[model samples]
Target: MNLPKKAEDAHAALAAAFNTGDVNTVMSMYDVSGFIVPEPGKPVSGAEKFEEAIKGILSIKGKMEIKTVYCLQTGDIAVGRSEWSITDGDEVKVSAKGIEVMIQQNDGSWKILIDHAFGAEASLVA
Candidate 1:
């Protein structure tokens, strides 16, 4: 799959990838050095780590829905705020807000740099 050119496109692509239950496709949106805070204080980095973190979600067998609340871009960097949910049929299994930083690569495609999946909830708990 091709990388997303814009923030909204990234979210759409992510949702599509998640629905397929393909971990490799989901990880394609992240940069090689990208990291995600899978929980309150623990941050997982690199492709291998990310794959491990994402496996649990895939096991649930659901489709993802994401809405980009806002995105601000400057030069090659962009910050985005979004709300996302994983649903089984009409029932939501998990929902959360996220804040992420994306970097525009040389090819002008956006790849996630830092993904704080829990958003403010993580800090509140810390």
Candidate 2:
């Protein structure tokens, strides 16, 4: 799916930032009002809180893969469904299905207004 221009850039930037494990660059991609649903932790808002959260995730040296879904836009809001696999080296730390609701800022930058992620694991059933 083809994402809108800025959204596409944001998606790439987010992936690069994740790979770099740079909290600031990652945060730069988000709006001031953006938020994140952290795994194994609490939700984060604003820069300071977000930074702390990223630091923790970065500490694990995680990477994310998100496929840009050609979702429509309404005003400044856009909807997306992303399938993500996060890894700390060779170990799959978090496998997830996430929905990101994004909004464009005044500067034409897109940020995550809401993020909800689910954990994926192989269940042992006998």
Candidate with maximal TM-score: 1
CA error at residue 106 for candidate 1, angstroms: 1.2
How far in Å is the alpha carbon of 116 misplaced in model 1? 0.9
> RMSD (Cα, Å) of candidate 2?
5.3
At residue 13, give the lDDT of candidate 1.
74
Give the Cα lDDT of each candidate.
0.81, 0.64
lDDT of 1 by residue, 1-126 (tens): 788888657777777878878888878888859788766577899778988877876787778888888889999998888888888899998888888888998998988888887775544464
Angstrom error of the Cα, residue 116, model 2: value is 2.2
lDDT of 2 by residue, 1-126 (tens): 222346545555566667766666767666657677766345678778777877776776567766655445788888766666678678997666656777887767777676654422233111
Candidate 1: which stretches are off by over 4 Å?
Answer: 122-126
Candidate 1 at residue 116, lDDT?
82
In the predicted model 2, the residue pairs found to clash are: none
